[model samples]
Target: MSQKIGILTSGGDSPGLNAAIRGVGKSARGAYGMEVIGFRDGFRGLVEDRTVTLGGGALSGILTLGGTILGTSRDKPHKMPVGGEVRDMTDAIVETYRRHQLDALVCLGGGGTQKNALQLHQKGLRVLTLPKTIDNDVAMTDTTFGFDTALGIATDAIDRLHSTAHSHHRIIVVEVMGHRAGWLTLGAGIAGGADVILIPEIPYSVQTVADAIQERVRSGKPFSIVAVAEGAVTRDEHTAMAAALQRRETASSKEERKKAKAWIQRLEEESTDHTLRLAHQLESLTDLEARVTILGHLQRGGTPSAADRLLSTRLGTACADLIEQGVGGVMVAARGEGVEAVPLEEVAGQKKLVPADHPWIDSARRVGTSFGD
Candidate 1:
């Protein structure tokens, strides 16, 4: 009897998901002669016993597809929304797993998905994960699939915006998504040649950003482009946010925790409109017309780039190889030139953050980019 495996995509969808799926399905069926089935809408489908068989025809021609054919959702097994109320549906999922008799379950997602996969592993189910976030913030991996495609999209947007900024002599502030991490914004900013680059890793000052733009103006350049991460914060806001998070971590009572949560929520709400606020501040300080552009989901849509497709296929096939070797409870991490089966415990609940002294940061600084620090 050939080994049978199940696959699902969880959390946010990305450009290379389908390629990754195709890689796993094709390799499992051809190289290892293993049977494969996909769960729809992530863990929710497992709970509901929704599935699709991944035969040869099902895996064909998905190498350049953008999203997952199996679909995805943000639902967690332990606290999933069933009917109307939230319920622990882990038992239902385990029952379905037993019914299918899967030798291993492959999950493709980002940081949250890693944590959720770890939970399933603790329940005594064989689980493996593949990192697939545009943010590229999954811990223990050199780079995640979907990031290269999104980086190209973001860089192109910034490149196009430069024309209007230069023509109108305007300060253009472009926001890129990365949640709490700065990899996306930092890489795009450097690649796009933005004058001011801001990310969550480096708390910035509005005054410093203004000064940088003003200095460019004094140097006979009246227009400047600013690349900012959506989670980028002013120095003052960062200080307050850090203090609130500390309070939440050390809270002794429910009421204290509640207060801390509210404080953090308020800060996040304020941060949501940070791009517009930044443009306004820059206009006031530099006396230049300012514009804002948010490359929101635009970065997440499109066929996978060549780099992304290659990485997805690499990780996905490595996942199949690990499962064939009876490996369980690990993520198929991309090392420098090869892959590694990193234990899920090391990856879950951890985020890969850019170091302040990283070579990328130094290179950006050398090219006259200001981080507004």
Candidate 2:
């Protein structure tokens, strides 16, 4: 009997996921003569034994697709919700692996999925992971599949904002994804020719940003584009603004209320002391109109770019090769020149951020891009 490989996508969905799935499934079944099975809605479907045969025409025409055919979820194996309580599903996952008679399992996702794949491998199931995330924060990989597509979307948004800002003489604040890293914001800002760029790795002050915009106005360029990561902080330094918002949404307890209030206070103080405050201050000081535009999910939803499609195809192929080689507890990552397998432990809970002294940063600075500090 041919070996059967089970495939699934976990964590947040991204463009090129379906392409990766098709790449792996087609190569596994057609080239290796292996059977491919897909688990829906991530590991949850695997634990529940909900699978669909993935081969033949089913895997066709998905190279340019934007989402996963296998679907995905943010559910973790150890903290999976069941009934009203969170339960560990590690054992259940192992049981399902045995029940399905899978020779190896191919997992596709970012950091969280890689961690789960590692845990599953520790439980004695053969596993291989393909890195996937718009953040491009997976360690060991120079870049991931969905990042290029997202960067393209974000850059286009910034470019459009430039025209509007020029016409209305407004300070457009375009927010992009990247909670832990600033790859999206930095890439888009530089490519879109934004006046100021803010990332999580670097904190900025409102006065600094305002000064840059004011200088632009003095140079007869009154309009300014500020590209900011969703997690980008002012000098006061609060992390994960999105997470903070989510926490505020779930704040019901007194302790939660206290923490939420503190978070809000910190955010307000930082904003009041920084760019938004500084923008209004600049208007009073320099008389330039400023406006904010948050490009939240617009960056995350889109068709995969050509680069992303090629990268996803390569990573997916590497995943199947790793599985065939009996490599478990590893993630297929693209290094400088070629692809290599990195231990999942090294990738999970770790993020690859833009280096402060990187040439890209130097280039951005040389071109007069202000980091707001």
Q: Best by TM-score, which number? A: 1
Best by lDDT: 1
Candidate 2 C-alpha lDDT tens digits along 1-373: 6789999999888888988998888878777789999999998998788999997888988887788888889889888998899999989899999998999999899988888888898888888888898998988889988899899999888988888999998888777887769999999999999999998788887778888988998899978998888767776555456567779889889899789878877775555334355456556655678776777676667688998888888888877777777777888898765789888778877878999998888999999999987
How displaced is residue 174 in candidate 1, in Å? 0.5
Cα RMSD (angstroms) for every candidate in the order listed: 0.8, 4.7
Candidate 1 overall lDDT versus native: 0.94
Model 1 Cα lDDT, one tens digit per residue, 1-373:
7899999999999999999999899888999999999999999999999999999888999898898899999999999988899999988888999999999999999999999999889999999999999999999999999999999999999999999999999999999999989999999999999999999999999999999999998999999999999989999999999999999999999999999999999989988899999999889999999999999999998899999999999999999999899999999999987999999999999999889999999999999999998
> Model 1 segments beyond 4 Å from truth?
none
TM-score of 1: 0.99
Model 2 residue pairs with clashes = 206-274, 206-275
Return the TM-score for candidate 2, rounded to 2 decimals.
0.89
